[model samples]
Target chain A: MSINKIQEITSKNNARLTWEGCSILLDINDGERMVFERLTAGATLKVGNKKCSLQPLINCPFGSLFQVENGTDGPFLSRIFSTSEGSNDLQEEKESPTVYGSKDNRELMDNNTAQSLTGEDIDELRRKGASGVEIIEALITNSATFEKKTSFSQEKYRLKKQKKYSPRVLLRRPTARSICEAYFKKRPEQIGFLRMDALALLLSMASVTSHSDVLVVDMVGGLLTGAVAERLGGNGYVCNTYRGITPYPIDIVRMFNFGTEICERIVNSSLTELCATSNVTSVSSSQLEEACGTRSQSNEEGPSSSVPSLDMGEIMISSEDGDTDISPASLAVKPCKATKVGQKAPLDAIKSWRENGFSSLIIAAPQIDAWSMVKELLPLLSFSAPFAVYHQYQQPLALCMHNLQVGKMAIGLQISEPWLREYQVLPSRTHPHMQMSTSGGYILSGTRIFGSK
Target chain B: MLSMELENKVSFKRCIREGDLVIVYERHDNMKAVKVCENGVLQNRFGVFKHSDWIGKPFGSKVFSNKGGFIYLLAPTAELWTLVLSHRTQILYVADISFVIMYLEIIPGCLVLESGTGSGSLTTSLARAVAPTGHVYTFDFHDQRASSAREDFEKTGLSSLVTVGVRDIQGEGFPDEFIGQADSVFLDLPQPWLAIPSAGKMLKEDGVLCSFSPCIEQVQRSCETLKSCFTDIRTFEILLRSYEVRGERLESWENHAGGSLGSRKRRQRSTDGSNGVEASVSATIVARPSSEGRGHTGYLTFARLRCVI
Candidate 1:
């Protein structure tokens, strides 16, 4: 975890240090597909013959294309641009024939043996200060098949060559969406299958303002937790609860590198702790009064503590010790050598939780039944507080919607998935991208309300 | 009304204070922003509400009027403000506002320039996004609209972070001082192409720009202008559909307690894809999509300003 923190320090929105260990989105096959790749110095980072590395960077290497440091002798290095907009539009580069036809033009095609440039020859060309465009130009000039191709085919051929020859890597800044995208691409299982689009919908439906006090149970580790915390702008608490001996997924949380205050907003409690302490809805008014009575007494004894809510720091620590993954450095647990903190933490959490009831409940628990999970949390929110639940399949979310209807617990329950389509709008060829991923999980949204309470 | 941020922070000052922007919630759909004053009185359908009575009450507290009617005085956030603010022109809703804020990457400490701050709905979100640090310079061609938006900003306590300017951005352009200074720019005018070059000039290298237009032709023309100075240009439309969900008493409903005609109509409505789970139990769930919903707002065309290498 500490090693990851150091990596994060060097890898943050920093444009100057996009060297080894930098995360990037590799545009492969002329932007047909995107592969999320992390850069490693002196290592072969190939996106179709475009090998890259970090070596002897005396100057900033942004706004430049990738190339070999010493051609065949050494590693890759980014060279300065000869001119701004180094690779001009392919169409304007050279005047070509008419557009390509659907069928292969066998009659017009020329069959001939061309001068084939070997690997060493290409390396020598690169070593002799030949640009990617110049090398492609030389190859096209020496090709016997170049004359028979149509204009459209020529553009396609040039783009293909550019992808293979052009050594360019985009150093993208890490945003919440980008990190989420990388997670979806690389480590999707850790995120409860909640895609970025569905998560977007859930956040909006929950009305997650910066001022909101949110109760979150992120089965997807801290992906949802981090997102909600970021949205809150460190203004409110993200009271996080998980079942069993679940370890907080700090790896994903470290990507954002939020400070101690933001991390402090993320208070944790086990289900054993929560279910044992309080179920305010099931309790009668007299019991509520008794609980309030004790809460006042506790507040008097622990001034500035607000009863158990503000006193569970010790409880959360011992409860977290069940997992070996908890970093000792991150948790400064005051040497309280007792396991009794778990029981008090939840009581304190609920006591503090009911004080300024949560404005929203955001859940991404595909592992649990959505209705049961939502039903248990609904009573904790203020009347008319909104909630959005995420499920990979619609069945569970739909069940929760039904339960909301039966109990009259919420209104305006909507289930939706954002329909996103990427379009390629070139001057000549304009249409939607050929390949697209449709499902971004399912989101069920509603507002909590009471009837004559 | 007090800003949600302020209300969330200053717990000691809980009551409705003078000059506070308060969201007076009369119903789910009917809500309005009322400026709280020491002795001001507001006459509504419920009764004449005295600001004096509401002065010492906490936010989210219910207060009574002279006629024994009551209303909720809640803190105002962008979402609530958007719903309650009077519309001078076609305004973006919460869905599109959230999408733009996220996609444009409007973090705190970023400089954003927007054109024709119509109704200031999106502008408010942008201000909130870049709050306590970043500043938003908004330009509107219409003088009255610009002044009105400026007044609204002042009333909402966002004047410090937002500066409203009266300028024809499409015809003239954004002020010269902001050229190459803004981190991102937004266009909500009819002919955004006329302003794209100016928007490009206002943006820093690799900065993002978004143009909201209802028609596809506008998006096409704006894309043409955007191509010269932009990369990765894309368009999107965001829609939010809400459902009304409620629990039903299965046994009580089956007994025809509401009479034949009413129950029959309810059953007809329920059978129309309401209850997917067919279970003979004590209670069942029912959800119907809201009949009143926004259909189409505008297409948000976002593009990144190409590096000026």
Candidate 2:
């Protein structure tokens, strides 16, 4: 209803206007266009021929309210300070007699004399210890009066104490951190080993997630994968892979037994592969050792390591070329009963870390096919162990071994998304290998490269 | 001082002293007396309490009057001043001000450019938001209005944030240095379409721009200029409705009646009941009735400069 009244007033004339709680009634010529706008609260209204403006001692809406007034005094202009009729009446009743008839009325009128004051006038008044009310009164008194009924109309009402308004800083609700914490609490068991990139993705998802739904992340960045594993309750596995030949197999066996059960199994298998591949003219044990040293050094200094770690078991696995005569099955050295070795392997080790009553599968692989094989073997070995996959150069992918289906779903969804199109390192000249179809599965048409360059 | 209980059922805690007068609460139904002893008592039906009671209380506190009515004792915050100040025109609301602040990135040490100081609501907000630093230069063609705005600034202790001038922004652009020095520019006058070129001259390379208009046609024209002058131009409206949040019954009166209905048929019946119409009537009428039903205040268009080049 107030909005309608405001609209009516604004539309009637092109005068700029404002509204407080009440409508301002301004005396303007009919159909005359005047600009209306807001001043700071407690702003005075300049009226008539006076140099000073009339300061309404009440809060009014910001905008101009217009109306036509006819008088012998050349159509004098007056703006309504407020329009709350009841309050106006009450104020009028209290101040009318005193303002009009009191001996101090002369001083009030003197104060009300409309005069134009510059910034210096205002400063001088302040220097003289004048209050805002006093300064406003002085300005009003000094200003011109274009209307003949100024005395009666102005004297008819008393100036009510103006209520002061100020700006406010709105308090915003808590951010995504609280919500993410709540989500993690609601399903503690669903969380697995998280990597840095995975954690970042989770944070992003938390930013947009509603109260419903569990978060699933498919980690595809190496050390970043380890970082995430640490943040999500550290109850998963770390998987690593190595490749080489001969005495390198011996070093791989030493590294496999160096950790837990899963770690030992992984190291033993890699050593066997190295031994079998040592006979190959193209590879040597010394080269294998050099590759291992290089991978370790790279992991220590990179953005890939920024992932928060989740406390979990680790299964270190490595592979290497073995002597051509050594059967791949013999190359499978299960360091413990908990470790599982597959048949079609050049040579690999499977070590399981089953301490603290939680099994974690850490798989380090040089090839996508090897990683896939480890993933397939995950459910059979330990359904609850969280699995971490580490790959150099390529995006490391991992899933909670216990929640195999969810892990698969997360990978499927990510592969279908267009996030890869924005990758900076990808050669732009070549057409993208993955395309998002209308139905949402990625239409893959190019050769799939796995493992580090 | 009479010992009589006031007819409005307001009880006096003490007598008024010299230079002190009792003030009644507007919404209180009962009469109560407050002692004006240099420290006056704000009395009503709620309870008789000393002004000292609210001295340290934060703004937005609900103090009880002598007659048991609740009186919201708002602190002398900038927003409260805007709520109570006299305006010669329509004023900007907190919703609009919030967006303007965010879009403009209004902060200390920035020069703000505004046109047509109407009620000075935005001006007050800008003043306070950028206070202790920053400056606001507002222009209006009417000398009387500008003077009035100047008075308001004096009262709110925010005259420093603003510089009121009597000039038409459309006639001549702000001075060269003033133009390029401004961090943000807000246009709240009619024919804001005419002020865009001035905005271009005045705004910095990545300065923010905003235009508040009451109609879509005005918005369309403003947008055209904004597209050429700035980049990342976006327009949005903010609607704020306060809800009575008391315990589990947090609800808004506007949405209470028809908000929970899940079925289309039931919703139709409810709508029909309110409008006295049959279900067979067009759904368009039920969904959106007429212009009268719309909250036709104005449209706000915002833009940001990507590069001067």
Candidate 3:
């Protein structure tokens, strides 16, 4: 009951909203329309045959629709962001007039009856004042395949036309979902092989609630950290153990518009600092951990513009305990401080870290030894706390699962790859889509069994 | 520090104090949710285990039974709770549940409507997904099942954010009071097509709707209905497989003799228990797919409600 009460009090601020400075994820109407792309305000974009104006006002709020000159016939706006409680004056965008009704059973004409329309005519018509849907109607009437195609192909043809003709552009505040869509579909290499579907499973398997205290060693450019923070909704904490001068994932995290309170909950500490903070430390253990947090800072990427540099006060607490004495020898080899990035992590988070002992732990760093990371972090989890480690290649997680099995530290070890196939649900001809992504990374989820073995 | 452990706040601490729903993990399949009482006993195959003894032990701490057998007293989380809860009907596992939660775009403070509450497994996750600020209005046709789910909601401490309505969603659409209120609507019924109209009506402008069906025929019918009322329609099926791996440490006496580790001991024989032995060139871990792999729960069809001015 208290969890419910706590949730009600906190959920108010998490709703999506739009403003002048908001970083919005726009579902672009291009051939690659399936992929959502990030766009900031005050930047003009070339939409399909049209110039999309994106002038932002000072703290201006965005709404679902806006009326433009001769805009009544265009395709409806799918969505835009606004505050939860307010009623905006903007008019709602209407659905496309050429509705593909499920009951449409019109007989098709023979193939020889009509020839495909010329590209020149379509270009001329588009230059004229015809809407995308209008041009699509012309395409259907002129195309030779129109008469011979099945209902599914007909629908597909219409969609192709919609994408080609419609110059629709939208601006909405970036949520974890949008940020995930932008990265996973657009820049898969940048975020590793982690897909949005896979990320969802990882979060759910870990039971990441609004009140969860989580531990993450995410190498997917801070996606996991931002996602956990979003679910936390400003409650609890996220300990992100890093291996560099600055945390890698902060760039994507800042786009979600998580408030200062939520940002504070995302505690950043070097992997070295984290391993050093552990109550039980050995020379070998510390030496192996050095490979974790002490990355020669890569200043090559330059500073990410959207993310605010973290304050140093949060990072320096680790040294105060002096529990694991900072080795003078290792510090002497400190990588040159080129354009000093983010903040230095303090050890203070360890005090709280020792108390809660993290309800869930996630390792998505494919570059690091996931088994070693799991071994070091197992003792830091609450009893029965679920942890999910992700790797594009199955061998690493397989080894981790084996080590966990041998060490008796984990149970219910599952390696899951979500099989996704989109459906082509057209009238009278529904089937699986022809093309789909085969893999979306692999996940090994299990519980930390801290019981006596 | 003291304030963090408020009576109202539920957290995984070391002890099973009063009001904690401890998950008695017997195995992956055999598990139970036991309410910790001052004088209570959990009688399982392990033996008679008193709740009094478990009251002060840390969660995941192993307590011996009167007959010398033992089991783990683990903390109850949403994911674990899903696996252990008594099944009243087929439920959504973590795989599909995660997919639905993400694609449906449900987040904190979003109002969601769920029909045919069945086992409340997905509902439990849904409740957690929209916690503290969001609420899940769940409806089930069966009177007994609906009331039972409501009771379960109270026991699981989700009553505050979820409401169990005992109306037939397909027969009589979601109560008119919620006609244009829900941020998202979910249908898990035999004829979700009949409920699609109601779902669309209840959804706010540009709100999303998801229907879970096991068969493709049901998916086809649902998509047909959805095309008339929604946009951006998609269908997905999620599969989860587990891998159980075992490690064996091998020592050699003849071929490719392995060197001895740091002068801890002098041994002529091979033992399988020693770990991280430098003398051994590699740690051979044998991994195989686990016997229990849940296949094809259902196809999740998600669509965004078309903005109808």
How much does each candidate deviate from the true structure in C-alpha RMSD?
11.5, 34.8, 12.3
At residue A318, what lDDT does model 1 achieve?
Answer: 24
Candidate topping TM-score: 3
Candidate number that wins on lDDT, 1 or 2: 1
> Every prediction's TM-score for the first chain?
0.65, 0.19, 0.66
TM-score of each: 0.72, 0.33, 0.76
Tens digits of per-residue lDDT for model 2, A112-220: 3343656598667655656445655664565564133244334332222121000011101111211122122222222222221223332221111111011111222
Question: What lDDT score belongs to each candidate, Candidate 1 first?
Answer: 0.61, 0.36, 0.64
List model 1 lDDT by residue over A1-453, tens digit each.
122232233212323334555444433222223333334444344433344554433233332333433345433555533323323344232232323435665534443355366668888888786767788888788777676677544555555465456644443444566556655654466677676666765666676655566777777755777677666655556666655454233334434434454555655554443443344456455654554454334333321221211111211222121212111111010111111111112344455455545667888876889977887777666654668888877667766776565454655456765555545444554445555556677788766653312
Once fitted onto the true fold, the runs of candidate 3 whose alpha carbons sit more than 4 angstroms away are A1-17, A30-41, A48-50, A55-162, A170-173, A275-350, A451-453, B1-13, B247-284
lDDT: which is higher, 1 or 3?
3
Per DockQ, the best of the predicted structures is 3
Model 3, C-alpha of A98: deviation from truth (Å):
25
lDDT of 3 at A208: 82
Candidate 2 vs. true structure, TM-score: 0.33
The model with the greater lDDT, 2 or 3, is 3
Q: What TM value does chain B of candidate 3 have?
A: 0.85
Residue B224 lDDT, candidate 2, scale 0-100: 61
Candidate 2 or 3, higher TM-score? 3
lDDT of 3 by residue, A305-363 (tens): 33332211111222221212111110000111121222223334454455556778888
